[model samples]
Target: MSADEDRDATAATPPELETDRELVAIVAVADNGVIGKDGDMPWHIPADLEHFKETTMDHPVIMGRVTYEGILETLGEPLPGRTTVVLTSRNLETPEGAVVAHGLADALEAAETAAREHHDGADRVFVAGGATVYEQLLPAVDRLIVTEVHREPEGDTFFPDWDRETWTETARDEREGFTFAEYVRS
Candidate 1:
C-alpha cells in the first residue's frame, strides 16, 4: 500500500457517544436563599436530610472541599453507598473512601466515571455543594433538587441565583418545615 493508504487505514475512529448522564445539583436553601452558615448547614431539618439521602443514594456525588469537610464534621466521614468526589485547588488529603479532583470539571468527570464503574449504569451525578461549587456547576446542571426551608435563618452561604425561566418545575412535596422541589432544565 502507498504511504497515503497506510495513513488512512491507521486513522482513529471517533469515540462512541457516552450514555446520557444527568448532572443534578442538590441543595437546601432557606426562603432567603441561605444554604449554610460558618461552614455548616444553617438548619437541621430531619425530613430534608432524609429526602437528600434518599435522592442521592447510589449516585456519584461531587462537592467542594468545604462541603466535604462539613459533611465529615456532621456525619463523621464521607457519605456511604455513593462515590464522593471532592473538588479543591489545595493540596488537601482526600477523605477516606473519597476521590479528590482539583477542579469542578475534574470532579464531574470523576463522578461520571464512578457512576459508570460502580453504579450498574446509574445515569445521575449529584452535585452536593458549598456555594462556590454550586455556582461553578450551575451552567451544566441538568436538574436541581432543592429543599426550600420555610424560615430564613442567619447564614453566610447562599445558593446561587438561577433563572427560573430556564428550568421547569417537575415535582414538589410539601413537608412540615420545608418543601422539596425538583426542577429540570428546559
Candidate 2:
C-alpha cells in the first residue's frame, strides 16, 4: 500500500476520538540515531532538559513503560504539572499521579482526557519515548519537536529513522550542545 492508503487504514483504528488532539513526538536524538543507553538518556544537556520541560509542560505526555520507568528512577515521580499516561501491556503498579494504559488506544484516550480536564483545554498529546513508542507512533504524529544532538554516542536503543520528505522543518535553533528543531507533517 502507498503512504496515504496505509495512513488511512491506521487513522481510523483508534481510541474513539471525541476530540482532535495533535500528537506530537518530543525527543532528543543523537546524530547516530541514539536516543537512549540502557534506560536513561545518553546525554545530559541542561538546556535540552529545560527545553523538554517547557515544550511538554502543559500538555499530556504519553510514553511507554520503559520511558516512564526511566523518569521514575531519576525523578522519583512523574514530571510535575503534566499528566503522564504510561502505555504497557504487562501489569505493573504505577506510582501516584500516573495513568496506566494497556494499549495505544487507551494511552491516547487517557492523554486526551487529561488534556481536556487538567491542562485547561490543551489540545496536544506529546509522545515521550523509549524508541518503541516513537517508532509505533511516528506515522500518526502531527508534529515533531526534536533536539538534534551533535554527538554520536553508542547506545542500545535508537530513535526510528523517519523520512525527511514526510515532514517540513518549521523552526530550528542552535544551542550549546544540540540544535532544537521543529517539524510539521507534510
Query: Which candidate number maximizes lDDT?
Result: 2
Candidate 2, residue 84: how far the Cα is off, in Å: 0.6
TM-score of each: 0.87, 0.89
**Cα lDDT, model 1, residue 137:** 68
Candidate 1 off by > 4 Å = 1-19
Q: Pairs clashing in candidate 1?
A: none
Q: What lDDT does the true structure give each of the candidates?
A: 0.79, 0.83
Model 1, TM vs. native: 0.87
Question: Candidate 2's residue-wise lDDT over 1-186, tens digit each?
Answer: 122334432232233433388888899999999999988888899999999999999789989999898899899999898999998888888776689998777888888889888999797999899787887677678888999999999999998878787679999999877899999877
lDDT of 1 by residue, 1-186 (tens): 121332221122112212268778899999999999999987787888788889889889989989898888887888988889988878877655689988655776788788888887788998898888777667677789998899979999998888787789999989888888999877
TM-score, candidate 2, is: 0.89
**Backbone clash count, each prediction separately:** 0, 0
Clashes of 2: 0
